[model samples]
Target chain A: MEVTEDIIREVEKGNRKITLDLYHYSFNVLMSSAVRYKNHKEDQMEIVNNAFVKIVKNIKTYRPGTAYFSWIKTIVKRELIDDFRKNKKYKELFKIRDSDSVQESVVEPEVYESMDSESALQMLNVLPPATKLVFNLYAIEGYKSKEIVEELNISYETVKWHIKQARKKLKSLIIENKISLKQ
Target chain B: MKEEKDHIDDFFKERSEQSSFEVPDSFLDDINSKLDVLDQKKKRRGGFFWLWTLIPIGLIMMYVLWPEDIEINKTKPIVSLENQETNAEGALMDSMDEQKSESILISDSLTEENITQEKPLNDTENRSAEKLKSLKNVLQDDVKKIDKLADENNPLWLKEEIKKQEVFNSSNSNNESEIVPPEVEEMAIADSNPEKNIETRNSNINATENAEIEGSETDFAIDENVNNVVVSVDSLGNSESEDSIINNEAFEIDSVQIDSLPTETEDQDSTLNVEEVDPSETMLAGGNREKGDKINHEIQLYGGVLNSSSNLILSNDSSTFPMNTMESNLWSASFGVMYRAKIKQLDLGAGLSWMKTGEKANYGTNTLEMAEVDSLIFIGWQTDSVFNQNTETWSIDSIPLYDTTTVTTYTNDSIFYNTANKYTWISIPLRFGYRIDVNEFSFIPRVGIDLSFATGSNTGTYAEIINEGLTQNSSSRFILSYALQLEVRRSFDRWHVFVNPYFRTNVTPVISSAIQIRRYNSWGINAGIGFKLK
Candidate 1:
């Protein structure tokens, strides 16, 4: 069902019944954003629920005529990051430099043609959590490096370094998968 | 290279957006249930705020209403003595009046009879009577001096004077009774009921002689005095044979009591000294004050780190957990306020603490085979009566329904998730401890029971039962646990600092859900500052 202005108004007024409808409407977008940070479906579901809880709590602050999907996506991403920060092990990995060197050889564009999103996501998991998060925010989510730096509270050099490490790891994974597929 | 990068980024973004996954039917129900829980938590938070606010007020009211200890010191003993006298004076005066009336009755009867059979004996009896009268005067003077010394708060001097008076009273009464003339005894026996007159005189004399003993020994003295009186009566060779036999028995009992007097006097002396302290006097003012009398309240503020490990046990024997399930120990922190009261070497206390404890679990992916049960409805033929308008008769028709049950098996791959399950609780611990002091430091070993309320929890992954579709977690709001600790403390005037090492475990499993039961056991150390409220 399409969401209208009247539904948004009722939801903003703490109508929990309408808020559930909103949950169903935005389930896909929330799941996709949650999956970038969490590897498990259960944790992703948890992140989505937490995001809806925030959206319902602060719906009144949303400006009308703005893109509602973008607004909800921002809330979901924030929830994902918050959940990630709860794990101290992941937080510690955010500062460590990846020891594996990036091979300078570039992959042919045809190599990526048959690769699906599930395999790509699995390949992305090989990178450290901080590098994966930075790459997803910058390369896929279209967030600028400066915006990433401000959100993550990291220096520009650190942001560039993580993206570089993420690219190298993804390239290595793609080449390995191609070789295995050929075999 | 730049063009290839753009194409690669665009392809990855498109694949991610196009990727689709199915949501389970139970997913919506789970979200709604979580929303309801969040709503309830919001309401409870408001109630908890007011509850927390009222707790300190209730404590203050208890402190205000506590009974105060009364102090009795050397300079203030007169005040304490006055209180005792004011409470006991009416009872004492009433008993004294009864004794005086009875004694006067016996004396009047005795004075009416004059024995003039032997002049020298009469002279000796007269001199002895004068001596008895002089002794009575001395007893009365001693009583007056006791009252005066008691008003002056001189317990030592008063105690010595009482001992001197009792010795004189005891020895004089014995000598005076033995010297009574034979004619006087004959006059006593010539009364209408000789036994009754003799018994009355004996009781009167004993009351006067044992006045001090009665005041100190109470019921014990009464038995001894009765026996002594009966012994004197037996010496008279009364006409009644039964009375003579009874007096002989009394003489034997009196002899035993007379022999036990010195041992009994030492015991009674100790009792008298304790009675002098008076129950109304506080320990601080009493000469036998101890360390416990100095402090009434000790408040401690503390913080500590807990290394918690969770043990998960299967809830049912139907299925065992998968081999890949793993948990790692997690670290959390707690802080609390504790109030204790010291009585001698024992410390009793209760405290409120907020603590977080949980573990990180990794449930790796696996192929799970689940069984589902489904019911199928079939239409069965049955006979039914139908009304026929024309024939006015019933016809049989067939209509039927039956249920059939079937089980279906499905194999699916379980999702992998690593969850850091954190649970927060507000705990109230009731503690008991014994303090042992060594040099400048005190070591206190304590044990306690904690009543904890689960304020909230953050959890993502759960161990699920194969066919039941159930997850393991706690649904109950309260958890009970036991704790043991030892505190090493160093004192600085009214303030002190301490480091406490402690171990705590849930008495019962804290988490019992569909799949498994979980118990949390933790080891921790806390350091805190304490202040005495005296």
Candidate 2:
């Protein structure tokens, strides 16, 4: 959805409800990202607040041609990555691998689809930040593992491995919860 | 397989679509309140920064208002009374001169009369009578002059002068009248003759008065001029016969005068004597009086007891037990204040502390009972030697080794064996000890008994499965036992670091059965640093 000038003006003029509505939208996006990428709630809130502040400050820079949602998504992604780097948790997720094909079988669609979105997100939150980021990009966002590698400055195989591990943990959680599913 | 894959995909997609996440209510309120507080703090910071600037000014005002130097003045009175007595003595001497002139005139008139009477030789008897009367008049004039001087001046001074005159007169009288001595004897003998007796009595009275005056003067000089008068009196007593006669008269006169004036002089002398006596006695008494003060100020007594033990040590042993094993290291510390009594250089104190040791060993051989079981041993070993830098490193190779033999053989070739193993006991050390202080540092060496309690049991046993006959199972048995230990600690301020190498022996045998297990006594070293609370 386009963030119209009217909405921007209303937010900047301190319209409480309008500002809260805008904030709520951004908060949801950031909270989703935090749940999908950071294990510690305290650290996730930090990532979310950082993304929200950037969005609030730079929202005026939103141009006509650019997709606003994609722009917002990009900001959230970048913030999450920055949070990972700042905390030095990124290294814990990715390891050096010689072959990209070695990690291909690790990520399974059934594991991701087996649980409800909220449950899957909660499971994702438990993953190391970099691994969760790689899993979100490769599996949920449907980005190619190589594209994820480029976006995150990581090896293609590391992206594949993170997706595989993320799916495996999600599968374990599903089994532990004993949630009935169609499969 | 394709149908199953499609079904699984459908199942997950459907579940994902139904899931939703909601923010907790408390979280939103907490965030809003935090933001409000942050804004308030930001606003107040401006005022707070300005307020902080006044702190240094306030401190400067306090410094200026503080009191400056304090002044104290104390005064005391001065005492001395030597000038008053000298003035009184000078006034008495002037009165004596007036009396002496009158006596001289009387004597001169008597001599003139005697000459006039001698010219009328026709009345010879009257001339003799006149001569005797003139002689009597001369003697009476002399007596009058002496009495006037004695009454005017200090009696002691007058008596001294008269004794000298009497010595002179006696010699002259002896020369002029060879019979004077005989006559004087006859006068003394003629008690019936009232006139002669009266003359004798007057002479005796004069001599006694002189003696009394002399005694009083000597006593006064002895009391007032201690060193000089004592020397003079000694010399006078040692002088020749004539001098002795004079001194004897003076002494007689002094004694008489002293007796007569006892009411005034003795009372004053006694008062002065008492005053002088008390201060000298107080000085001597004060010398010993400070002993209580010295004891109160000079002695300080402090004492405490400290116990320190090593927390952990690691060791490896084989043969009797498992072939490879690891042990944990443990240490403990306890400190307590002791009632300390210190006299001069010696210090004495008593204190109590607690200690504990945990250790375990595993045998490689699997027994029939343990054949299907897998076990892991968590070994904790601690020694007091950790604080000792000079302690010889216990070579891992030097640890005592023991062997075990199978007591029972089974059909499966499994054998049961027992081996001896020794473990250190946990100790609570109570020490009554002392330390010598050298400079600011103290070197303490203490001797105390370690009251060790059996905390845990350690036993080593060798065993094999009955079916595995060819496979010999060697096991070491461990049973917990208690022993005594001795420890020494060196302390610094609140931190005490020490190393204790202890000897521990098993109080009970490893195996109670037929096969005697050769148990090795375990000797370990431990060291640790501890803090004192009191």
Q: Tell me the deviation in Å of residue B365 in model 2.
A: 74
Instruction: Output the worst ten-in-a-row residue range by lDDT, candidate 2 chain B.
Output: B226-235
Candidate 2: list runs displaced more than 4 Å: A13-16, A63-68, A96-114, A126-129, A168-183, B1-19, B23-534
- DockQ for all models: 0.16, 0.06
Best of the candidates, DockQ: 1
Please tell me which predicted candidate would have the highest TM-score against the true structure: 1
Q: What is the TM-score of chain A alone in each candidate?
A: 0.86, 0.71
Model 1: residues >4 Å from true position, as ranges? A1-183, B1-45, B60-287, B291-295, B316-319, B323-325, B367-416, B465-475
The docking quality of candidate 2, as DockQ, is 0.06
- The Cα error of candidate 1 at residue B512, in Å, is 1.7
Tens-place lDDT digits, model 1, residues B1-534: 445556666766777787775565666777888778777776787799789757854774565455444221121111111111221221122123234322222222112012222234466778655554554344335434434544555345334434443443444456645544443343223222323432333343344434443422211111221222111111111122111101122222111011112343332221111113233332222133332244357889999899998866765555645522577888999999888888778988887899988888786645455443545567576577999999999898775544434455667766666777788888888899999988769999999999888875434356565433325465347889999999999998889999999999987777776566777899999999998775
- Pairs that collide in candidate 1 are none
Evaluate model 1: give its TM-score.
Answer: 0.39
